[model samples]
Target: MRLWLESAVAGTPSWCLYNAVLSVLRATSALIISLLGVSMHGACVSAAGGRLNSRQRFLGSIVVAWALVPVPGRPQDLSRVEQLYEEAQSARTRGDFATAERLYIEVIRRAPELANAYHNLGIVYFMQRKYEGAAEVLEQAIRLDSKLGPAHAMLGLAYYELYRPEKAAKELQAALRLNPSDTNVLIYLGKAELQERDYKAAAKTFEKVAALKPRDPEILYDLSLAYMKLMLESIGRLGEAAPGSHQFWLLLAQDAEARGDEEAAIRNYQQALRVKPDVIGAHYGLGSAYAKIGKYDDAAQEFKKELQISPDDWLALWKLGELALRTDPDQARQYLARAVSLDPDFPQAVLAYGRALARAGKTEKAMEQFQRVVTLAPEEDSVHYHLAHAFRRLGREEEARKELTRFEELAKKKDERTQQMARRLIEMTRAAQPLADEPEPGFSPSRDPTHH
Candidate 1:
C-alpha cells in the first residue's frame, strides 16, 4: 500500500508492482491494520486516499478528452506579424522616425487591432509636427485599448497642438482618471486649460502639478503667467474707476495708443510719468508719446534717459532718430546710424538708415541701404516704395520703374485709403527733381545784390 501511494504521488508507470505490494500488505492485514491504528499512520492514509482519488478522476477525464479532441498537427505561424512589430520597435528605439512610421503602418495593415502600433504611429506623426494626424491615430489606439493611459495622454497633447482645447480637455481628463498619479499628464492638462483661456482652471491644475514636481521651473513660469493674466484683468476693471489715477492713467494711455488715439495717449502717458517718474516703460512710452505730439526735443530727452538705463535699447534710438528727422537731419542720421550698428538685423533700422542717408544727400550709400532693406523684407511694400525712390534719385530709371510696378501691384491689394495715399506719393515722386535743383524755399538772396 505504501508503494502504491508513492507511485501515485510520483506519477510513475509502475501500477503492476504497486498492486503486488498492496496485495502483500493486505495478506498481512491483521498485523498491518493493528500497527496502522496504533500509530498515526492511519490518518496519513485517509488524507492521501481522499487527495489521490480526486486527482486520479481529474486526470482520467483530461486523458479521455485528449483522445477525442482534434489537433491541427502543425505549429501556429505568427512570424510575419512578430517580425514587423519587432522591426517597428527597433526603428523607434533607433530614432529613425521615417522608417519607424513605415514599419508601424505595415504592422497596422497586417493586424488592424494592434493598439500598440497605432500608439507608436501617433508618436511618429507628432515628431513630424502632424498634430492632426497624431490626434486621429491616437484616437484609434484609444478605441482599440480603452485602458491605454499613455495613448489618451498623447492624444490630449496632439489636440492641444491642433488648437482643439475642448477635445484636449476631454482626453486629458480621461488620462488622469486612468492614471491619477501621472505628473506629466497633470502638466499637459494644465497647459490645455491655459490654451482654453480658463486661467483659474489652469492655475489649479498647475498647482497640483507643482506639488508633485516642486522644483520644475517651466511649471513655475506657467503658474506665474496665469497669475499675471488674472492680475492684469483685475487691474483693467479697476482702471475705470479713477481716470487720473497712476495705474488707471497708464492703462488708459495704453488703450488709447492701441486704438490710434495718439494725442489722448500722449496726454495720459505724460500724466502717468508725472505721477511716477521712475517707470521705465513709461519713460520709453513717453518718448514715442512725445514724438506723436511733435514734441521732438521732449521726445529726444525721454529717449536719452531710456538709453542711459538700457544703452542698447534699439526702439528708443529709432524713436529719437525719427524725432530728430523733422528738426535736425544731421542729428537724425547720427542716431539712425547708431541704431543700425546696435542691431544689424533690425529691418526697420535698415529702412530708417536708408531714408536718413537719402535725406542727407548720400545717394549711392542710401541706394545700397534701401536694396539691403528690400532683401531683408521683400514682402514689405514700404521698403519697396523706398527702394523705388532711392533708385529714381540715382538715375536708375529701369530699376526704379520695376520697383514702382511692384509697389503698385502690392498697393492695389491694400485698402482704398492706403492705395489712395500710395498713388499720391507715387505722383509726387514722379513730379519731383534731384535735391541740387530743389533748393529750400524762403531762402533770402545774398544781402550783397551785386553777387546775386
Candidate 2:
C-alpha cells in the first residue's frame, strides 16, 4: 500500500498536493506527509509497511523513518461506495434532496479523502437551502484539495447568501486565482466588494465583468453605481478644502461628463457659470456635452458665450465654426478663418475653413486651405475626400479622380479595421464564459492499493 501511494505520488507532480494545501514547503511537514500528504485527501496513517526500509536506514537521509500511503479499501467496499455516490447524485438531481443528503454523508464517512463527495454533499446542502451546512462542507472539500475551484466558488456563493461579504470575497478571490475565467466567481466577487462598501474594489471587479459582458445591463448598472460613489467621495474630499467654489462646480461637471451623465454635466456646468459668471472653460464643457446629445444650436450658443470672455480662444472659435457649418456656411467661414489665422496648426479649423470657402464658391482659396490640410494631415481620408471635391470645383477632372480613388481605398481600409475591432470585442465576451477545471481521471479507489 505504501509503495502504491509512493508510485502514485511519483506519477503525479511532486508538489501537486503539497503546494495545493499548505502553499509552502518546510522540513517537518515534508517529513510526516511528504508523499501521501502530497494530496491531503491521501492517507496519512503509519504502520510497519509505512516505516522506512533498509535503503533509507543505510542512506541516513530519512526523518521519522516511515513511508505514508492512503488507507486501503476493499474492492467490494469501493464498488458499494460508487453505487452510493451514483444514488446520491440521482436523488439530488430529482430533488429528493433529503435522501441525497443522507446518502452523501454516508459516502463521506466511508471515504473522507474523497473531495468530490464533500463537494457534492455541499451542493446537496445548498439545494436544501442549508447555507451554513453548505459552507462548512465546501470548506472541508477545499481543505482536502485547494485546487477545487468550483468548491471555492460555491463556498463563496454560500457565504454571500449568508451575508458574509468578507468570507465571500476571500473564497471568490481564491476561485478566481484558480480559474480567472469563471464568470460566476467574478460576479460574486463584485457583489461581495459592493456589499462591503468598497466601491473602488467593486468597480475594478465589475469593470472586468463588464469587459467580458459588454451588453450585460446589471454589470453596467453596478459599475455606474461604483463610479458614482467613488466620484462622490472624491468630490466630498475636495469640498472639504474649498466649499462651493467655481472650481468645485467645474470639477463636478467634468466628473459628471466622464461618468456619462450628460444631464448632470450640463447642470454642473451651468452652476459653475452661476457661481462665477466668467469661470473659464465652463461654457466650452457645457457646449461639448450639448454637442454629444446633438443639440448643435445650443452648443453653438455656449461656444459663442466662451468667446465673449476669451475672444482669442482658437478652440472656441473652431468649435463655433464647426457647429455653424451645418446651418450658416457664411458664419462658419468668418469664425473658421479667424480660428485658422489665430492658430495655423489647427487641422480641424483649417479643414472647416476650406469647406466654408468651397461653400462660398471661392474654389481657388478653398484649394489652398485643402492643400494645407493635406500637408498637415496627409493620412486623413476625409481630407482627401474634401480635396477631391475641391479639384472637381476647379474643373480639374483627372486630379479629382485620383483624389477620389485614394479616398475610397483609405475608407475601405478604415472600415475593415473598424470591423476587426468590433469582432475582437465580440470574441472577448465569448471567452469570458466560465470553464470548470476538472481533475485528471487516472487515480481511483478501486485500483489495487497493493499493486505497486
The most accurate candidate by lDDT is 2
Q: Give the poorly placed runs of model 1, Cα more than 4 Å off.
A: 1-172, 175-197, 200-256, 259-279, 293-298, 305-312, 427-452
Steric overlap count per candidate: 0, 4
| Candidate 1 displacement at residue 281 in angstroms | 4.0
- lDDT string, candidate 2, 23-57, tens digits: 33244546545543232343333344464455543
Tell me the tens digit of each residue's lDDT in model 1 across 1-452.
12221121101123355447645654554443333332222232322343334554444444444433432221122466667777877776666889988988987786676677788788778877888888889899889889888788888888988998989988989989998987777887888888998888999989888887788899999998888777677776786676567777777777687677888888887898788766666667777767767777888888898788777777788777867777688988988898889877666777777778888889889878877766766655666676787787678999998887887777777667657766776776677733222111111223111100
**What would you estimate as the lDDT of candidate 2?**
0.73
Q: Give the TM-score of candidate 2.
A: 0.58
List per-candidate RMSD values in Å.
Answer: 19.7, 18.0
Q: Residue 50 of model 1: what lDDT?
A: 39
Native-to-model Cα distance after best TM-score fit, residue 358 in candidate 2, in Å: 1.1
- Candidate 1: residue 230 lDDT (0-100): 73
